[model samples]
Target chain A: MLDINKVKQRIESLKKLPAIGSKSVKEVLEENGFSRRDFLKWSGALAVSLGLPATFAPVVADAAEVSNRLPVVWLHLAECTGCSESLIRTDAPTIDDLIFNYISLEYHDTIMAAAGWQAEENFEEALKKFKGRYVLCVEGGVPTKDGGDFLTIGPDAETGLSKLKRTAKDAAAIIAVGTCSSFGGIQAAYPNPTGAKGIHKVLNKQVINVPGCPPSAKNIVGTIVYVILFGQLPAVDNFNRPKFAYGMRIHDLCERRGHFDAGEFVEEFGSEEAMNGFCLYKKGCKGPYTFNNCSRERFNQHTSWPVQAGHGCIGCSEPDFWDSMAPYEEPLANHKFESISADATADKVGITILTLAGVAVAAHAAISAIKPPKE
Target chain B: MKITKKIITKIEGEATLKLYKKDSLIEFAEIEFWQYRGMEEYLKNRNYMDACVINPRICGICGHSHLIATSKAIENALNIKITKKAKILREITLGLEIIQNHIKWFYITLYPSVKEINYFKALEFSREIAKIIALIAGQFPHNSYAVPGGVTCDLTNLEIIKVKNFLSKMFDKYQEIIDINGKSEDLEILFEDIPKETGKGINKFLVLGDNLYFKSNGNAEFIKEEDSISLNKNVLYKGSFYEVGPLARNLENYLIKKVYEKYQDSIYTRIFARLYEVNLIFQYLLKRIDEIDINEKNYIKPTKKSGKGVGIVEAPRGSLIHQIEIEDEKIKSYNIIVPTQFNLSNGTKESPSPAQASLIGEYEKQSDLIFKCFDICAVCVSH
Candidate 1:
């Protein structure tokens, strides 16, 4: 449903007037001791990550070269700045993250110089000048209660809700950068005091939801790069998430699948089974039901993800994961899934969901076979 | 009187400083954080282990601090006595997180306010340090790898060697940039414009929680919260203002002592204290990383899962406290008092908060510098 022509038109109309001493991605890479070959290799890897063919590496490289012409306005809302922090710390120093440096970042409070009236004026001017030519990246959720005064901005104390709406009005592409913006995150759980909700819930338009507590920087940066590369929105799922990244469940690709299928499980935190890197099914991994690329792409520069670090996948990338994925250390069998019950095993759930790996031995990995609840 | 309202950006979220100037000096400054997410309120009735995951969402930059605090609180509540190896891993991750945060604070947050130096180099190094974290704690900013019993990570010798390599590379970069040594000329270059003698908040300092690098088992019992004009809860020690951060932690260090004695509790001391603390922590972690016995158990199963407990941790900003009371296997109450609340309490004109007091006698631009000197987190303060 992404209109490629509209994105192309916006790219063509990027004639606004803000001079940010931008550098070309190639120049930046070379300046930072990376060679031209490194740039091409990184571009190729990025193309692979974006699910584009190896032949599209040149197209991706072309996107990086002209990425500086794009204006980005990153907004912080009723959530932590993890997504923004994650963006800045996105350091394989790869082609994926280099897109950030080259993009004309018009208004991001984290790295932008201006504050108060200068900041407010710069924000106002960019929206006016760039109009429909800027990419808007929002990091948190919107609080709709108390007429949206819970979060305010600048010297005039403008409401954060209004700032988001105003910026989103003319954005060439709107990206809900984190889970907070995409699915209301933790603040919308149980007794939601601030009445916090996802950006899409309040806005009239659709946004590309890149959901994660602090999503893998590669995924976050890759989404942005996808926009600049093809000049169109990436193919998305039912949740408006890019299919390349969020298409498969984390369980499908989890390295611990053999352990789960073999009926070996970590009974407790420091148990022998845990040290051996056994399946964390008994320890309550949400990886099976959780849809994400954390198992594949990993985090912090392809180093290690949650499961590799020895904890169960917390399912941070799923919608309303905070509420739905509660009693965190317990299995999801207790939840109100139609096919699942308290005594159900991964094998049963795997069978019910045709796509999930048939966990033939999940019944053997259950509570009775494993360590029972200790008082 | 000339009143000027300015929104302080580029820190962990933003703050509005309403300054009232009499002649040239600021007479009284009011700091307001309009952002509020009811962190403690939503935490109510959540499952006990759930708090360890949810509490860290309070602030992205210092989530490790919250994770440590929340994890420790659950440990204290449920009588979960983790192995020493587990403690070491937890402390290692926490230390690296501080280094990562300080790297950003120095380059991304504090540096640009002073100069236009390209800080991406520091960010690159910080990721090396963060990779070390991901190696241990899964991820940075919001990794809930630290559970109550212990951390989830079981380190390999390869990971240990990788951590050492990262630390070596990190220090190699650190040597190039930060050197607050009394003999070092870097301080003059970094804080060239600002009057180094300026910033003197409530001179008193405080530190809470058991620490890894520094020695502090300060109590959170004396802490109290009162209503303030700012959206942040006004935190006080026995109902009075006190400073709580790096300057509080390291007053006696050779690198910071000379400067501290020269400009007691000023921005120079505060900034140097943080910078020097980075130097000290990096050295400490280098040695501490060697002490990890991977053969030892990472955790111990708790006997009880219900009780009242408090967890205090010295986050990058300052002391972070998480108090929890679990009843019938659920969180009956959860309270979080972040470091920013201690630093920036918009108290009455006669008696402002520690960092607020620092802004009282400065010009507009310098006040922004001084306020950032405290390194307050608007997100944490409201949470």
Candidate 2:
């Protein structure tokens, strides 16, 4: 009971914007040799990925096509370029369309054609031209130690920290793209030699965080599209992640939840229970604590996520995951401390408590036997 | 007269290339990786197992390679033995990583720079390969699926079917690329258009790690000695620059032995080697997937203890090595020599580094193409 003609009409009007009307969403898909059916499928999948109903696919398609694509300046700092790579490697819209049709990726160090001074010049021009309007997407963390000397950006000897601050001053909003940019990923782990910090800490602002080791491409694109459509940042959780993407714990919607509740757990990898697709909680899955829509919006075009692949979630989307999520093979919230000499203090304490309880029970039984005639 | 210092773009991470030119002929080219996060230095005193998760974040493209390397290093340190099924799964994941990486390099990075081949089709193929990776390794870019003793994931029949289907489709697409570029089934023709002497470096090839597709050529002793002695801030082997990655892997393969015999080390050979490996690795992955038995144990519980060990993996780019010294179950000191450190090192007094030497000629117009031939990953270099 779908009105294909009405949907096409809605798409037609949506593609009428002067800035983005040159290539209709349909035309863009066709240019990429994708049919209208493929576009609809993508829109529906994107809607689901964004935690919206299938009926909202038309609205998403319309919002994506009609809105004037924002000129995005993506910055890379003291971390890997994985976020950008993930964005480009998405299968739904194709990376080419996402770059060319959706957003004006004015300056990206990894993928841009301009090199050296020219690239720097392009960034300056874009910043000036779209001042107080453009959206700044930062992928990596900022190294704040030693006056930000750890990570430098341009030929002018400008550090990444300094550059980010200057660029963010005029930006309408910022999108912290990955865990590194959002929560000082691995670089900010123990010892943190270079003193890397996320953008929120450096900027002291409520930048929308898409916090995953490398967040799903759909979430990244969906958040940006929401910004363009609503002319404001989407609703975010306490962690500054969009509610649509990071609203619920991965455990809430995990496919293995039934098994978890049924008390069928995978104690060991490649065990019979593991082969039968039991819950991975016992093997240290952090899905119950981690907040990300990975279970529903699986990576690589909804193929499969970590739990489905028989691995427990490492809680990459959470803040301070490196420190808080250590000893990945053990369950969270379970406490057992062991010293470097392999002395188990927690085990000793447990044994003492159990022995004392047993002795108390025996003493009470003997006392009761002695007083048996009183009742 | 003046050093043409320029910031190189279109690579994974950012770097500054300083061409010390004397007249038209370049005397030397020094590649300075200014972006440093000190990952190794910061890893000190942290839990040794955390390295498996942290090391992968060094470079997004080759994160799985790092994860496997870290896991292997920990396994070596603990003397833990993984089951055959776990080893096969690890190799499958690694194979998928390499295939996806090479496809992306060919289509996304290299083709656009060289103005050769269809980028979109190549992107689609790589995306499929990434799906296979995610199917097995949980996700691409950063998945800590490989723990110390074994991988976290165990294969089910459903996963096997999914991976097999994607692999077949990928094989077909790869053949299409060969057909379109080479006019034959053989992929060597795809490199026929590549100019000789382009991006040629020292003939010395260094390959480490053993997998189903690739095996070290009985050079373990030499590799260990070189790994221990020559690895510093400026990574070198036997006091000389050496090349690693696809070209090195291809030099050892029999299928592409003729190509290696013809062109020892050049841009043409490097590109051909990468393309050849895509086909070679795809076939190997399919066979490995079929060989996997889900009934076997996937991991052995690792005990907290003190030890020192070195782990090496043939990453998509080259050999990724991780050395860990554990004291009381915590990492006392850790050293990581990424493949880029081997290929993209700053030159020592003995000779110009491989990356620097490749850019010595007057090919400024084809500088990006020449650089892409090396598959430069600045993130790994800086890490």
Candidate 2 displacement at residue B69 in angstroms? 0.9
Best by DockQ: 1
- Predicted complexes: DockQ each: 0.54, 0.47
Superposed model 1: Cα runs more than 4 Å off: A1-23, A91-93, A336-375, B180-185
lDDT of 2 by residue, B80-180 (tens): 89988889888888988888888777766666555544455656666777878888887787888888888767666877788788787778777765532
Candidate 2: CAPRI quality band: acceptable
Worst 10 residues of 2 chain B by lDDT: B223-232
| Model 1: lDDT of residue B69 | 94
TM-score, candidate 1, is 0.92
Best candidate per lDDT, number?
1
List the pairs of residues colliding in candidate 2: none
